[model samples]
Target: MAMVITVAIAVATELAIVGAGPAGMAAAEVAAGHGVEVTLVDEQAVPGGQFLRQPPPQFGVSDWLGDPVYREGRRLLERVSADRRLEWIMRSSVAGIFSNGDDDGDEPFTLVLNPVGEGDSGEGGAPRQLSARRVLIASGCFDLPVAFPGWTLPGVMAAGGIQAFVKSQQLVPGKRFLFAGSHPLQLVVADQIVQAGGSVAGVLFAQSSSRALALLKHPSVLLGNADKLSQTAGILWRLRRAGVPVRFRQTVLSANGTDSLESVTTVPVGPDGAIDSDAAEEIECDRLGVCFAFSTSSELARQAGVDCRWDASRGGWIAKHDDNMASSVPGVFVAGETTGVAGSDIAALEGQVAAIGCAAELGKIDARQAVELARLPRRQLSRRARFARLLSELAWPGASLFDQLMSDSATLCKCEGLTVGMLRTQLGRHPDIRTASAAKLLSRAGMGLCQGRYCHFALTRLMARQLGVPEERVGGFTSRFPAKPVSIGRLIGDDS
Candidate 1:
């Protein structure tokens, strides 16, 4: 195997964090406070990640949509900024991670960083290299795509995508909107739109109110998360006061438009989870927002040869981590969504735990001290994780929802323009192709710019349903280095 070429150009640090989101920022703060030299890197120009994405500095927008979480994020960003030992690499992405140690021992991790905007004057925008004794992966999660008829319409977008535009850029996706998704986060997004002076036509929640209320069965979990409950309830109240129709057990069956999204068809889901087509209703709207759940952005962890397994509650395959957030790799640690689909609170705690683990492993803190430092965070993590599990169960998409929404003509792989009919036909013609990876080889389903991030979960479910197997049997595609596309010039180095 090719090894990470360590040259003089590479900067060295005691700890290197791949993402500057909540988990990463928290991890950097803790490590730096403990006198460790740390480097924090993120793709965005800001540090808040997706959950707490901030408006651009020039936007002059002081209102954080009346959400307290954003205020907390601002404070976290300030703390990260004031840390003298923490180095911030903004507007850049980690192109690849290279290390070789299967036989010899743990090797120093070398990360290739590619600038996001404005090409550096050099061959392939010559990437900078960072070598670290210990690495933490907190790459976070992305919006899960739901494939349905007319979903490729110009005005249709993922709910989280719409929120990102509204929150980070202060740009509304459309004048009038309809939100349909499995998670309650969609309602939160709708609240944002309304708060931003935009109109929402309606909100369709896939899970019924009774199903959601079932979470209350774990009273301690619900009571422990009283703050989150209050926030959610407040958002719901605002939507109600704004006259936004929030309907439960309803999902968008299709989107329709000639040039852009003009209307959407929705149907009530019965107790059995099948769409009650007899009660289908068509509502006109300029834009449609849809999402089911989120999948962990674990490409970097996978690239590092970390062990992973299919986790349904987490939305897909996740890197395996222990109580200390240490991954299968000796010197590499993982936290936040990269490990699983827990929310931002759990992610922050995980980061602190990972930092403690790293400090102890590096001899900066003794084992006893590390254990003492990790005790409270570990307890908090367990409590939050239990509540997260309840939330996941409540928001879990019904298998029948996919069957009702996705038609044979609906596009599955947007990057390759592959439709459901095309995929089904391919599977029928080749019975031997059972797994998603095998289907990718035959049909090019996931061989596009996204590298299957958008279509992997949907494709896996489709394949599993067709083959009468569990979703786990149809595994995800094997991730490769430079997970996202980078200029060829960067890969070859700046010879000029």
Candidate 2:
């Protein structure tokens, strides 16, 4: 083979952290411990994720805003902050994932991040691109709530976004709410809202208790961490004790109100996992907190062209990885929820494992010692994986949920203002429309108001079903420069 040479060199100086969440912070902590210089970057100004959301200005340091996972995340970031080699860049988001060459060493890969104030400047005020012997992506998960007829109403929101609102701004999305979802996240947010003095009509599960219990029957899950098991039990108990109705095997078919959400029409799913319209019931609530589940935030990973898989058991399509937490793309390693559905603690462990693996790959650590060091985190991760699988199965998005709202007009691609009928036609015309990229190109399905955040999952599932690939294998959209919406003038490098 002829040796290929390329001029595209990724600037190498220090290890770059793509996120400042639990996973990123943990990776930086372990990597720094191993004497590797680390740079941590994130869209948020703080370390804790949307879960351990930062307190408002009104609160100094209140128990009003802390969780075990969050406390652990803060401690890890604190340790990383103390390290002289670590750099924490807040209010920065990853813009692009570029590989100048292949694994043949003809080209190198670089991660580009745009700071909040500094816009697009290929040179001046351009994003800081760090070349590294190894890179860890712990970007975390993004939820996709299938849109209903009245979902665009002012008060309706994703269960996760509502939680973020409370955590960040101390703002309640609505005074009266009905949280409808099965995941542990739904309950977590419901409790947060109630604790904040908001009235929650009920918390409903689209999946049946039998389904959830069936997942718990997995022997690996049964033997998983006692803390998580106990925590789940406590949440269920609290819901029951508080007289909060927990409905199961129910789906919120539609929300109806003039300008805002007023009530939702929910229906029951039968034994064959089909929704029965005749069993519909109208529940009055100010807000509908809805989300099926979440998958890895693959914006950066996909841009780098890392292979992904639709492991429903791991929370939809996720980046593929080996025991070392390294992706198929050699130096590009993935940690945390970006890889799978393991909780924050598991993500932290995976981040540490990636750091250890990175150190060995960079020849900073002896292979023999790396092997020994990898065991503890791996064992802990195995336990968490067991629980994660159980949780995924317990809350898997059922096909019938879509069938319940399968309308010719029900908006599927909210970003592009696209409906199911339009997407179907576009898919037929462009048989190659098998990924978020294709959808964006053909029908502009992900190019509307929310910028594909709401429609990406539906596009993935629809395309996967059409192409006969696992949902995760369907691929995702490539994140471009100005990760978030930025002014063109700002992108053109003008502060004033």
Candidate 3:
């Protein structure tokens, strides 16, 4: 069920799945049911992806959140692990996906994999490769990096990153945490921190509660998600009892401290997401959790030459998938947040539909059977999509908010230590710097270690706002191969 294939030779398979998240797990299960062979590659040691992120074995964590919140994920993981046909290549990342044949040829996909923690030393291990007849990418999303002043400080981190620490490390990494974001995930993280005997200074929402809560009035959004609704109510009730302030129409204007986060200034944001700087309040806290938005982890998809369309509401560029979740590229399928940032429930639904489509295409099942198998998941996905849309609408801090938060001195690209002032100077010189790619060349904003993951959106926002064009015209970075950083040694090993 699992392996650490250290060989440089590529192990060919019928289907290769990327990511071991909810969508990937679901697809593996469905693919197995169809008697299809699958090789799933994930960066985590465990099967669960971010949503079901687990504590490392050394942590000795056994409590499963003490709720049914993770029960389904646990079950899914158990089922996937029990299947012998589904092979898991854990603790490894697909550095790049190369077509094994000509551009027009339909040859297998060659995946260059680097051991997750193994440095390029070529001492611990060599870079490996996996070959698959067809590929499915379900790489999820990550916290949207919005650079306000002091966000690059040591103690200032994304809410999701903080939550990942709590979930995967069994350690609350901070004290006196102040959460400022429009995403509801922040509430879950706050509750987790509070339950772990940590202090929550407060949780702030930029949008007023009434506007977001109005969507709950819809019966469709409320139905079939009782467990989730109950869990939310419990979290809210516990936070209230803990005397943690949950404020609305508030946003973190800027963080304060020279070396680490000591406090953050909060100000009331208008419906337009512009802050009223006069009504600012400075709150003392060691940790600042910013959860404004999430961007699709589509770097690999883009590198694989798949089509992506920009939709800020869906989280930057989303892979273009047909109804069956097959991407524009032949034999390349996509699901979950890579398609767009709906919830995990919808992710599983999309995974099921995608797996069924894969099964049909592989001749493992008949088209009629595939249609019937996909019907229920598709129906459920439609319902879940509605609720997710409502939630996304509520969580999206208006596009203007990024420009307003980006002060001249704020670090736009943390990796390169590039600031807004530096970017503006480059724009003044270039005059034609209208896209992230161009800006990256002119200002070196996106050429950092993160490859513009942290600064591309902000840079695009800066360019679009300055040029008075949509962020679409101010396009995202041109994705390149070796999507993640790889050692020169590994590249040599892959080549040799």
Candidate 4:
């Protein structure tokens, strides 16, 4: 059940921070230390974001993330939850943020909040609107949707989604699991499943072991992230002891089953990135967990008129920010993976810098003090940035390379039930279709219940290549207000 928060929004706050993960939590800590009044909101019921997602207080759950690997996150959560200065509005989402057209910079933004889950009474959002002098968007990222053969099967799931089930719900959704992808995230999720006493068929990587090792052996990666490296090594050791096979240069060709996944076809990829279908191996597993990359949740920022750019290696359509993490628009700031797909450590540092920047902007602190506070976090961020670049290279598997995995009969838009051939026919019918929005209207690809989040990545790749343009030129779906779906009952509910 959602936590129905009773918000009294009679007055405006000096700063409003969205997301309660590392970035949002860390920012609130700094804001409190600097004596700034903050309204910290999160879509989750708890403080932890995706990386440190914790179960609700009433779940009677404990010690899920208590492992040594998550020590830093645990410490941060403890500090932030104990902070009384920060006001929280949890289990709710920001529908839209509108800037006052006038030049009055003081409290110039209005935020519309709507209750989520079944607990909401479906009243039209009126009294829920709140005012803020500044806004920090730290909305995180989600799994990169890969539309391949039989990807929409009932038993197929994103690797991160599987991890969430085990971590928060303490329930393994499937008995047997097969993980396949380019990034090491699959390895981590597989280890979690194994620890949860779930059967694992195997873990496959598209890249060779040598290439991944050389990147891990980088001096910067080794020195700056010793804890992270240690945790990864521990997870690998556990997986090996559990008798889980970890293979290299291997990828999933397709998932075959009647109604749900009963088996998966695995194919070996050569050093030149060529798939060897003649030596395909069939692995029986009830679940297929695929982790290619991540897609940032920057729709709210974009809807607020913030500028964003695409970098397929990182989370796509990321908000552009300056040294202080301030967005191009005045009085609006962003941090964490929404800025890019860096890890939580880098996100926390960026959050501190953004908080101090906000304090300076709102006159709670002097310019010199803000610089002094941000200097250390900025220095730490630069060191982490070097390692993040190396990881990006490993995470990025060009969309064209997916041709070997996805077949023409594969469903492109699960929401619309549109197949790859259907989309291709639409593209072929209209040679001038270049942008994603055009492709959406022309082919009806991203028009569905998911609002294109699931299909947009795949659609952008197809449209960009067909039109001979970059994904950036293809542009993302037009970020509309009410970024999340609201019920018609709520829309017409009496404001009184």
lDDT of each: 0.81, 0.70, 0.83, 0.81
The C-alpha local distance difference test score for the whole of candidate 2 amounts to 0.70
What's the residue-level lDDT of 172 in candidate 4? 96
Tens digits of lDDT, candidate 2, 48-136: 66545676445665664455434555666567656677777777677666665665452255666566654333323544565555678
Ranking by lDDT: 3, 4, 1, 2
Which 10-residue window of candidate 2 scores lowest in summed lDDT? 216-225
Counting clashing residue pairs in each candidate, in order, gives 2, 5, 0, 0
Of 2 and 3, the candidate ahead on TM-score is 3
Clashes of 3: 0
Give each model a TM-score. Answer: 0.93, 0.86, 0.94, 0.93
292-409, model 4: which lDDT tens digit per residue? Answer: 7888888899999889999887888999999999998888999988898877777888899999999998888999998898999999999888778677777666565676665688
- Please identify which of the two predictions, 1 or 4, would achieve the higher TM-score against the true structure: 4
Cα-lDDT of candidate 3: 0.83
* lDDT at 409, model 1: 86
Model 1 CA lDDT for position 485: 69
Model 1 bad stretches (over 4 Å): 1-9, 102-107, 119-124, 213-226, 494-496
lDDT of each residue in 319-367, candidate 1, tens digit only: 8989889999888899988887877777888999999999998788999
Write the number of the candidate with greater lDDT, choosing between 2 and 4: 4
lDDT of 2 at 107: 24
- Model 4 earns a TM-score of 0.93
Instruction: Tell me how far the alpha carbon of residue 221 in candidate 1 is from the true structure, in angstroms, after superposition.
Output: 9.3
Pick the lDDT winner: 3
In TM-score terms, which candidate is top?
Answer: 3
